[model samples]
Target: MNLKNNIETILGRPLTSDELNNINQFKNQFSIDEDDPLIVVLALVGANKILIEEMPKLLQQKANETIDLHRQTLITQSALIAKDLIHVVASSIDSSKSPIQRATPYLISFFLGGLSLAIALVLVR
Candidate 1:
């Protein structure tokens, strides 16, 4: 493949005149022909540089996605656990208990669930 064409294909655009001149100068300096196998290596090195420059952003995006997923999971788990606790508390309450006593467990469960969700949100950030 033509080195200039290959590099342009990889970059998704045609090279500038200055870029073409630089390639030509390098080839002349190294006594390298246009069809030399080293042209392929040069094109690949250029592609590698582009990929390396983009790598950190790609990794950070994936990391953010993973963190969001974990946060959602934590919130779901907290809500479920709180619901189950409320059910257990309600079932265990005595029928003879006062109205305030019967409502206390539910209030506590809701508070704990909210606290857990807040913690998960903070951790994700």
Candidate 2:
């Protein structure tokens, strides 16, 4: 009943050989890519939200564990979105590389605001 391990398991695809070795060797697993990891992490997070609602008894006595799980998922998801925006903002600032450079910040702000609203709705329900 280790929730963190269960969350890691339900993420579906396996990590790379080096990643597995690093994990086994107690090495820190830094993020390798941007979009895919964010998508996968967020998707897993969304699925977890569904599970919490559907299986209420899974959280009865373990209230603190449930809260911790939710908090960790939220923090990971937020960090992923931040990482995604970093690439856009970095490349967009080069006028020659991206004509829409100035718009990226606005896009990121809008996305973050929307995500916040979505999270509020999810939690309130």
Candidate 3:
């Protein structure tokens, strides 16, 4: 297959001298066949097309991994908050009982001391 004719047929135009020179340079640099540079060009183009097509999916997978990591971090933070809240509530409940329990004994002792003083005064009278 004539490379120049094939390129002109595909492009629907005549090749410029510069374009032909560039193609010749590319073929020589890559050691492509003299008969058809189209095969090498097509292979390179196809590989680039595949990489372009798969880019979005690869980016989406990376995005999913990032999202999952963020979700796990949030869950762990929520659990820690819940644990701290539970500790606060338990301490409040314990402190609430302590004051009343301590006050009850002091009140009972004061009542008994007043009654004893009143009985001694009545006997003296």
Please say which candidate is ahead in TM-score: 2 or 3.
Answer: 3
Per-prediction CA RMSD (Å): 4.0, 23.8, 23.9
Q: What does candidate 1's lDDT look like per residue over 13-72, in tens digits? A: 887787778666766888877778998888877656656876999999999999888888
Best candidate, TM-score:
1
TM-score of each: 0.63, 0.30, 0.42
* Residue lDDT tens for model 2, 26-81: 32244433333444554456446545664767566489777778877776676666
lDDT of 1: 0.77
Deviation from native of the Cα of residue 90 in model 3, angstroms:
2.0
Q: lDDT winner between 1 and 2, please give it.
A: 1
Candidate 1's C-alpha runs over 4 A off are 7-34, 98-100, 119-124
Instruction: Write out the backbone clash pairs for model 2.
Output: none
Clashing pairs in 1: none
Question: Which segments of candidate 3 are over 4 A away from where they belong?
Answer: 1-41, 95-125
Question: Whole-model lDDT, candidate 3?
Answer: 0.59
